[model samples]
Target: MSSSTQVSGTGVVAPPDSTGISIIVVGGGFGGLSCAIECKRKGHSVVVLERVPGLHIQGDVISFGPNAGRIIQRWGLHDKIWELCRHVDKLVLHNYLGEIVREQPLPLPLWGAWGYDGHRAEMHQVIYEYAVSLGIDVRFGYTVQEYYEDDAGSKAGVRVEAKGEVVSMEADLVVAADGVKSKARKYILGYDDKPRSSGYAVYRAWFNGQEQGVDTDPLTDYLTKGEDAFFGWIGRDVHFLASSAKGGKEISWVITRKNDFEVTDNWSFPGKMEDVLAVVDGWEPRCAATLAKAPSCIDWKLIIHDPLPTWISKSARVVLIGDAAHPFLPTSMQGGSQAIEDGVVLAVALQLAGKDNLPLAVQAWEKIRYLRVRESQLIGEDVRNRWHRCQPGDRGPMLDVPRPEWLFAFDAEVNAYEVFESVARDIRENGYNRPVLPPELAP
Candidate 1:
């Protein structure tokens, strides 16, 4: 196949490119898929390995701010994705007492970013299928047990199960988009830093509103009665969020509160409705009325790791992207968006650096991303802390989520093309620069 050829009948119109590097991407989620797609679109040969047996659309609401929306638009998946999204019209904030705090209109123009927020599985499938359509090689049920690279050998690879036996697959570069509990950390960091609690947990649930009786119940029908609705109620130390999507066909809800569950190696466990009711007891009556209909929820404990020293390994042939490299607090809703950004920027980096400068491309990509990701991660912590300490006067400005242009308005693909040269040159002369943390974050 020609480097610039578009897969027939798909109308993918992958942007023209000539990088021609063979890349192996680990994980098939948003980050991994984005990496594979962007790389292929840029004319790189890419393979994606996912441990899961098959594609599963099983997660609730996921958002893609305009920064990432721009990337999706380039891929020709925007309109298709919007069709499957909830199309939230506004965000209505409420106090625990049921009094309205603020009802803000949706899609704030942070520079023409029509951020899509909808079922996680739905958004993921749009990207996943698009990658497959482009003739990219994506293998599922192929669990990667280890990642390895040889700068001296000029290659990187992952060992995975194939035909009932482990096989070694090699490429010019290997990407670990593996999740938060990534084993790749040991290889990249030399030591795995354990994840500590962020002192919070969320009970998440999603179900058919009609089936769950929420759409018909007099106390809760308002949630599903009209256009996609998003509601949030913040209390002393807890916050409850609920929404109607799929045009009232589905209902989703979550409650983030102080974590009372004992910390353990595993941070996710089953949630009890009684516990949910207990925590949300004083919230608006409709809040409990809606929650009582939930079949069940997952108690997910938010965990954090110290700022990583590097996302690239010594070989520079292997690197970590997405959750594996920098897991975000839920408050930083950009976790998924930034992961997609990493994929886009990485492809641009490799393309511009060319095949011979793999080391510089890999390391410099990390330097280019570190500070932006760190600052975005900090937003979550700042917002969560303020929400926890919610005060009488804080309901207006403090509760409103900031949608800044510097963050939401970014176009990773174009930015990479513009800045890669300067950033890469800086790395060559001075070395890959890592930012120093604020005194409060520094240990």
Candidate 2:
């Protein structure tokens, strides 16, 4: 990402005891940025190669649970980041006809909890701008065509397409934060790790309220007020979630329904308005009206894959971090959070392992994270199952979104420090262990 503006940054200074390790992070999304930022914080020389030429400030709402929130705070941006987020006081749940089921308050105060629910592009800027302030070497428009590592040479790297020619860049560690269609996956796994259809797809839209004429209708004008609101509608085989943020200036909604399209490299396409309306027929009037206010929408297919055997390659010099390693369902609401956790933990693992024992560090990091990530991924599936199977009149616990302390209460950096030594020792002696096996998260 290229920028001419000066940034004061979070005043996060790199440590003096540099790891003396060279790292290359592929991708410029949230996950990739997090890894590069954390690695730099730990005094490692890092370069981020993003295929995009400039920061594309696209995307609607994004969330950062407390688990990821704590890491942002450490970078001294807790307030600056969360301030731009919508102030969602509660999440109201209802049946298809707007029958109120439950009105759940924000699990914790927005600022106190440190978790943020805000615009995706804005949240990204919060992290990216900080990375720039720290004077990080982020090379935009650099696309990785392939990933490689040499155990013999004790290095890892990626070949990028530059000036219509391939350029090779090597580093001690190469992190694939490349998203779902990650080129690194096949290279790391020695096979095409294809994604399966989740049998569900989300039709989503985001637009400004007053600008879209939403406030003109009494049926939907409530959304134009200067207060953020969240509402969910559950049904037999579908669920709809909508929220208004930025003091009701803008609105966004997502409706999940069964999908039968063939899987391809393309995961999103323009959604048909009729199809979107059909999903909510005979449902809440306000819900339909709000959806009607949407100027445009996209059909986003939720893709899944059976958990991989490993995120690290044979050489251990290359590793997958975010969506490249694990993709979470929307219901899980922890995809981005988990990706951030991976970056933080991996950086900590590298520090503890020292520069020479790089293999041990990456292995220990995977072992430490694998099971917890699997368990977290399943949470989204379970929530979707429960909501999709809901009988219209269900009540009480059945209409709950579980934000268990186990998931949100985690402090990744501290946890990494606590577990690294023993996990590294265990991996060195006995190899990696898999204690939990969540069923394949595919329909």
TM-score per prediction, in order, is 0.94, 0.93
Which candidate number has the best lDDT? 2
Put down candidate 1 lDDT per residue, 1-443, tens digits, no spaces: 76466431122334433565889898998889998998887777899999899998676777778888888877888788887777776789888888888777666434865688788898898898899898898999988898888648599988888669999999999999998988888888888678778878888888888888887789888778766788988888888888888787788888889885565779888888898899878777988998898888888898888788888888788889999998887777788999999998898788778889988998778878888888888877877877778875566665876677799888777778778889888888988655566666552
Report the C-alpha lDDT of model 2 over 1-443, residue by residue, as the tens digit: 22333111222344633778789999989999999898887777889999988898677777878888888888888888867777777788888888888887775543345788787888898899999987778888899998887759499978999667899999999999998898999988899988999999999888888898877898787666668778888886999998888788888888899988788989899988887888888987987888888888989999998888889888889999888999989888888999999998888888778899988889899988988898888899899999999985687666677778888888888889888999888888897653345566332
Question: How many clashes would you count in candidate 2?
Answer: 1
Q: Report the poorest 10 consecutive residues by lDDT, candidate 1.
A: 7-16
Sliding window of 10 residues with minimal summed lDDT for model 2:
1-10
Clashing pairs in 2: 332-380
lDDT of each: 0.82, 0.84
Model 2 misplaced stretches (Cα beyond 4 Å): 1-17, 110-112, 151-153, 432-443
